[model samples]
Target: MQEIVSLNNRISQVIDNIKKVMIGKENVIVLSLTALLAEGHVLIEDVPGVGKTMLVRSLAKSLDCDFTRIQFTPDLLPSDVTGVSIYNPKEMAFEFRQGPIFGNVVLADEINRTSPKTQSALLEGMEEKSITTDGKTTALKRPFFVMATQNPIEYEGTYPLPEAQLDRFLLKINMGYPTMEEELEMLARTSQNHPIDTLDSVMTIDELLRTQEEVKAVYIDETVQQYIVNLIRESRKHPSIYLGVSPRGSIALMKAAKAYAYIKGRDFVLPDDVKYLAPFVMAHRIILHSEATYEGLTQLQVIEALIEDTYIPIRKEL
Candidate 1:
């Protein structure tokens, strides 16, 4: 109980620090942190200039860890992202030079604007949490969270991310436009300077590592586990979905739920936790049929429909 309270307070502090700049998007902030705490990556897809980069920057600034940003373009090369071995004449040997990816928080700005080969560079780093090059493996630092952003409006020259790449993201967040009040506040806040410049680190790398470990220890009842499976199965059988959530999605959902519960100051998983996160975790993983797309049926809609039809388990008194 004491540990839970300590963690909850620390998380709240980080959220508060991020909120200083990210005004009125607590849900997005929480979701991003949830992905981080779950030891997974986040993919932010939205129209450009909706504080997408700001959100990533603020989160990176709030941590006492190395932050790097790679502005992916058509000319970006895999070696540019994962680094390459360079021959050093002075030592008569080749020395490996680390790329921008060797950081705690990496922001892949305009990720889709790059070629598929360049985008695939992140595949190994994101999933394995390490980069293998020249038949050598280099492990990333602890709490290696990726906040990759792509422009949804400009698909003209963008290469669509393959399914394998999409599945690696534990959550796909859309930072919608702010309300009128929020817009005004944002203007006033940034009139002089950006809030991120004044932001300081509220948490350390050690605390973050400990919290991530604790997230995995959050309890999940057996019935809740079954509930997650049921949702996954329902997605497979849904008419609108041509391809359903895979076991990876199931595992991602479970891990996200556990981390979310920990953030909520609870040590046990609840049915509502799974329901709240299912769409974000499972939607991007499913493939909608062409007919369904023509009919304007979205992945979120299909997942919501499935949630409505799936059974919810009740907990009995111990």
Candidate 2:
């Protein structure tokens, strides 16, 4: 749609501005923005001090959305995340106190540090865009997205996210250490204040919602769709993987591939889009067998092999 085109231009401009603060990782920034436009949550799994929170904060600042950061810890309670229902003695009725989950952009810093029960509180919000409390439901703001961060599994004090929770995220990305030049520039900039403070909003909330619609409408040939499905099927069959991508993962890859195509300024998706996104869209959702890990095979590496092992169909350009 023409409306989508306008929103696409706006998104491009916004990411460009965020780049000034983020300084490198253009691909990661675009993917984050893509997940936002798709109205999906993004789980950023990387170690601390690599600008994970900063990336989310900068995007929040750029969107002018209500930003809330929940520092997940071992002691965090479920009600602490989904909000609690309280009785007001004066009103003689139970009323709900909204929690940080109400915001448009939620920075779930160290999400894995929280207990499994606490992490489960986000499921309803992430999937249904609403939260239920005391037999009543409250709708989350439009364009709601959770940008969750977690350290690598090897890190201490981290718990693995439940399979149910992991499937809800549209994509998982890592913001690895910046290049040497970018790091030097970061040091020079941080001498004053955080670079994110200098960022500005790129588009309005309505514009963001419109962009999500656009990604849904991005053209994908039937053959390409089948290609995506085949890849998911192979993941299930692969010897290395104990658990493959679910039906949800199949759809996530399709949407992410469409978003990736649009970022390259294409209205229609190509095979490369599927290949580039296969790892990020499918990797985190998979479970590698203990034997595979013992043999030093990673889930992502297995996914890469699956993509290679599967038969890919070629599509004619629209």
Candidate 3:
């Protein structure tokens, strides 16, 4: 229990630093870092000017982790993302040249702008946390995370991510438009200087590893586990849904909820924690029916319907 509290404090310190640059949207910041500690990737889908790229940079800065940005575009190639093996004529040997993916925090800015092939290059890295080049495989550093961003408003030239690739991400989040007061404060603060430039590292790699270990130790009630499974099963049963949450989605929700509990400074899980994270964890994994699509309904709204329909487990005294 003491260990859990210590990790909670460590996570809080790191998040407080990131919020300095991100301004409002504390929930978004919490979800991003939770995914990180859960040892999973994140997909940020929002409109432009919402600070998607800035969020990635700020996270890397606050953790003192290695940061690399890959501006994916139509012209981007697979080798450009995963690097290539070059035969050095001077040494008469093939030397492995690494790519931007060799970092603790990789910012795949405008990921959907690239062709499918280029976008798929991230698949191996995100899933395996490693890359293969010329039949050679290399391991990425610990705490490796891919914080990818996409512009939801514009899809004219973008290649949509396939379900298989989408399933790899633990959670899908968005930095919604800030309130007027928050925006005004942002303008006042950044009038002469960007807040991120002055940000400092709040945690080390070892500290993060420790916190991740602590998250696994969080207690999940048996009823809560049943709630998670039934909620996922319900996604498949929804009348507007053609497809449902896969087994991978179920596991993602479980892991994310545990991390969410830790962030709330609790050693035991809660139904509310699982409920709060359900949409983001299952939204991208769900497939709606043609009729539902024609109605212009969103996956988020559908998940909300499921949440309302599902029975919330009553909390029992431990």
Candidate 4:
């Protein structure tokens, strides 16, 4: 219990530091951190110039670890995102050259703009935490995370991520436009220089790993586990959903809810925690019926409806 509280305090410190640069987006910031603590990748879908890159940059700066950014383009190849093997005559061997994917915090800016072949390059790293090249595999650094950003408004040149690729992410977040007051403050703060440029690292890699361990230690009641399963099962049978949440989605929700509970300074999971995160964790994994889309219905709305219909476990176990 004491350990959980200490970890929560440390996590709060990191979030507070990030807020210095990213203004008025506390929920987005929290979800990003939750995904990190859950040891999963994040996919941010939103319009451009709305701090998509800035949020990721701030997160990288707040961590005392090696950071790299890959500007994914249409011409980007698999070797470019991962690494390459070059034959060196002097050494009489093929030396492997590491790419930007080797960093602790990697920002894949405009990920969808790249080709599917290039996007597939990330699948191995995101899931296995290692890259295979030249018949040898190289593991990524500890606390490895991929913060991928995509522009939902622009699909002209972008390749929509396949179900398999999208399932690799633990959570998909959308950062909507800021309020008038928040934008005004943002303009004032950036009048001199960007805050991310001057941001400082608040936590070390070792500390982050310890917090992740604590997140794993968070307790989940049996009933809560059933609740999570029910939600996923309902998604499959739901009328609006053409493709339901997979087993991986069930695990992602359970893990994310544990992290959310940890963030709320609790050692045990709650029904409310699951409720709050269901839409975010399961939205992208679900494919709604065409008629539902035509009716202006969304996956999120369907998930919410399911939640309301599903029974919640009482808090006695906690």
Candidate 5:
């Protein structure tokens, strides 16, 4: 019980640190932190200039982790993202130069603007946590998290992310335009100087790694586990859907729920946790049929329908 309280306080400190720079996006911040604690990547789709890059920077600062930003473009190559080997005249041997991908928190800005080939370069590292080049595999640092952003309003030259790549992201979120009051606060805060310039690290990398271990230890009941599986299975059977979520999606949802439960100061997961996280975790993984698209159906609507139709498991006493 005391450990849970301590964990909550530590998480709160990091959250508050990020809030210094980011205004009126508490849910987005918590969801991003949930993905990090789950050891999963995030896909943020929204209009430009909504603090997508700032959020990543603030997170890296708050966690005291190495930060790298990759401004993805049409001409970006595989070698550019995962690094390349070069011949060293002094050593007379090929040496590998680490790319921006080799960081604790990597911001893949405008990811959809890049070519598909270059985009695929992230797959190996995102899934395996290591990049292989010239028959050599180098491990990435611990707590490696990728926060990728894409502009949804522009489609002129952007390449749509493949379903496989989308599935790799544990959550798909949008940082919508802020309220008038929030924007006013933002203007006042940035009038003097950017708050991010003075933002300090509230937590250490080692402490974050330890917290992740604790998240993994959060208890989940058998009934709740079955409920998660049932939800995934239902997505496959839904008539409005084309390609349903894969087993990997189920695992991602379960892991995300555990992390979210841990963040809420609970040692055990409840059905409500799964219910709240379903759309963000499962919606992107499924593909609606062409007919369904023509009928004006959206992914969120389909996910919500699934949630409404699915039975919520009764909470069991721990």
Candidate 6:
């Protein structure tokens, strides 16, 4: 019990620290941290100036981790992202130079603007946590997280992320426009200096890594596990979906649920956790049929329908 309380307090501290820079996006903040604890990547789709970069920067700062920002463009090369081997005349050897991808928190800004080939460079790093170049692989740093952002309003010259790339992201979220009051508060706060510049590290990278391991220990009931599987199975059978979520979706949800439970200071997961996270975790992974798209149906609507119709297991006592 004491350990749970301690964990909750530490998580709360990081959340609060991020909230200082991000005015009123606690839910987005929580979801991003959930991905971090789950050891999964995030895909943030939103309009410009919605604090996407700020959120990633604040997260890296709050955890005291190495932060790297890669402004992906059409000219971006695979070697530019994963690094390349350069010949060293003195040693008569080819030396591998690490790219911006080798950081604790890497923000792939405008990720969709790059070519598909350049975008795929992240596949190996996100999946294997290592970069293989010239038949040699280099392990990435611990707590390695990729928070990628794409502009949804503008689609010209942007390459849509392939399904393989989308599946690697555990959660797809957006930072919507803030309320008037929140915007006013933000204006007042930034009148003199930006809040992020003054932001302090509230959690260490070592502590974050330890918390991630602890999150995996959070117990999940067999009934809840079945519920997760059912949701994934239903997506495959849904008439609107062209390509349903893969098994990876189920695993991602279960892992996310455990991390969510841990963040809430609970040792066991509840059905409510799955219910709240379904859309964010599964929606982006599905592909709507051409007919369904023509009918004006959306992914979130389909996911919500599944949740509404799917049976919810009775809450099991911890």
TM-score of candidate 1 versus the correct structure, residues matched by position: 0.98
The segments of candidate 1 whose C-alpha lies over 4 angstroms from its true place after superposition are 315-318
> Model 2 has how many clashing residue pairs?
1
In order, what is each prediction's RMSD in angstroms?
Answer: 1.2, 1.7, 1.6, 1.6, 1.4, 1.5
- Quote each prediction's TM-score: 0.98, 0.96, 0.96, 0.96, 0.98, 0.98
Q: Show where candidate 2 strays beyond 4 Å.
A: 1-3, 316-318
Answer with 1 or 6, whichever has the higher lDDT. Answer: 6
Candidate 3 lDDT over residue span 7-55, tens digit each: 7898899889888888887888899988998899999998889899988
lDDT of 2 by residue, 114-208 (tens): 88999999999999999998788889998898999998878998899999999999989889888999999988988988778778888787777
**Model 1 residue 239 lDDT?**
86
TM-score comparison, 2 vs 6, better candidate: 6
Which regions of candidate 4 fall more than 4 Å away from where they truly are? 315-318
- Per-residue error at 48 for model 5, in Å? 0.3
Give lDDT tens digits, candidate 4, residues 166-250.
Answer: 9999999999999999999999999999888888998888889998999999999998999999899999999999999999999
Candidate 1 — what's its lDDT?
0.93
Model 1 weakest lDDT span, ten residues long:
151-160
For residues 1-318, could you state the per-residue lDDT of candidate 6 as single tens digits? 677679779899999999999999999999999999999999999988999999999999999999998999989999999998999999999999999999999999999999999999999999999999999889999989999999883577788999999999999998999999999999999999999998999888888888998888899988999899989999999989999999999999999998898888898999999999999999999999999989999899999998899997665677
lDDT of each: 0.93, 0.86, 0.89, 0.91, 0.94, 0.93
lDDT of 5: 0.94
User: Which residue pairs overlap in candidate 2's backbone?
Assistant: 62-201
